[model samples]
Target: MHAIDVNELYHILYTKLGPRHWWPARSTEELLCGMILIQNTNYKNVDRSLANLDAATNFGLAALLALPDGQLQALIRPSGFYKNKARYLRAVLQAYHDHYHELAALPTPSLRKRLRDLPGVGNETADVMLLYVFMRPAFVADSYSRRLFARLGQDAPYPQLQAHIAPTMRLNIAQAQEFHALLDDYGKLGPDVFGLADQYQLKL
Candidate 1:
């Protein structure tokens, strides 16, 4: 079987799906807060929670930080896991506020490490923040990416898969962001879209 060409796959997906309009947030603070609120929840719930937060405090990091614990939890209740999520969101926002200026000056690797050090920020979440929020050339090898590549006969864990694919594409920030969005949206289309079930199969 031939190796899956990451560039080719990216192009194919992009051609079919166009732009994904992903990471639907207006500001870095909103995106960061979303990075926490979105955990273990669906997009709709996250959207609703973001809307609730916006209505209450205009979705500013400072605003969220100023909210009382109960108020914060209540606003994000729609996203589920309200108790833990509120704590994590508060911690992340506080950290971001503390280092807001310093963060913009850090390199991509350093920024990713710093974000990872924050509460509830994992590799995938950090990558999402890097690509969408910070506009870094980070590839998010999330579950959708894994499933999509696995179907095309390239199955590896997060780090390996990320390393394998990131360099191959050599994408700029905009392209990298779109690739992730397109891949995830395509993954949600099941095994039939683009005849992927057969077309992308390994030639065993």
Candidate 2:
């Protein structure tokens, strides 16, 4: 496996795919709910679940929190794991609403810690919230990124990979968010699309 230049790869993906405008949420509450509902499911399911939720709550976290477990579960049933996710959603959103102001005051590291402390927010989910929701510079070591780099022959643990890419790839919040989106979008494409099977030897 050859060494991959993180910045160079970012440029390649950006030039090829252009702007992704990702996270695909109109509000922070929707984004957070999507981030949780997205676990163990595809975006299709998440979108359907988000629609159901939006119709019910208009993307209000407080409204979502007010829903009974069964009702919430039914709304998000399309996302799969509805029972567990409903519980997680209630717990996390309650914490988010109660600590909303306090979270805004936290420095990035502390903020990430606080997010991770929420019931369903894992490292990747915390990073997503940090980057997209909190508008912080965070490298999300999500599955897409892991797969992309591993195929490029530079596999590493989540923290190590994130640390490796963050400095060079995450110049600021906007760039970080774009870079992450590009990686995921590229990962979703056919391997032949980017010639990643040959370790990113460009076809065009």
Full-model lDDT for every candidate: 0.82, 0.81
Residue 186 local lDDT, model 1:
89
Point out where model 2 deviates above 4 Å.
Answer: 1-4, 196-204
Candidate 2, residues 48-160, lDDT tens digits: the string is 99999999999887688888888999999999989989888887788778887899799987898888888888889889988887888788888888887777766888888
Pairs with backbone N, CA or C atoms under 3 Å apart (clashes), candidate 2: none
The numbered model that scores best in lDDT is 1
Q: Which candidate is the best by TM-score?
A: 1
What's the residue-level lDDT of 20 in candidate 2?
A: 92
Taking the tens digit of each residue's C-alpha lDDT, what string does model 1 give over 1-204? 334477667777888989999876788889987888889989899999999999998976767899999998999999999998998888888877887678878998889999988878888988887887778888899988888788788788998887777666667888888999888888888854776646765321
RMSD of each: 2.4, 3.4
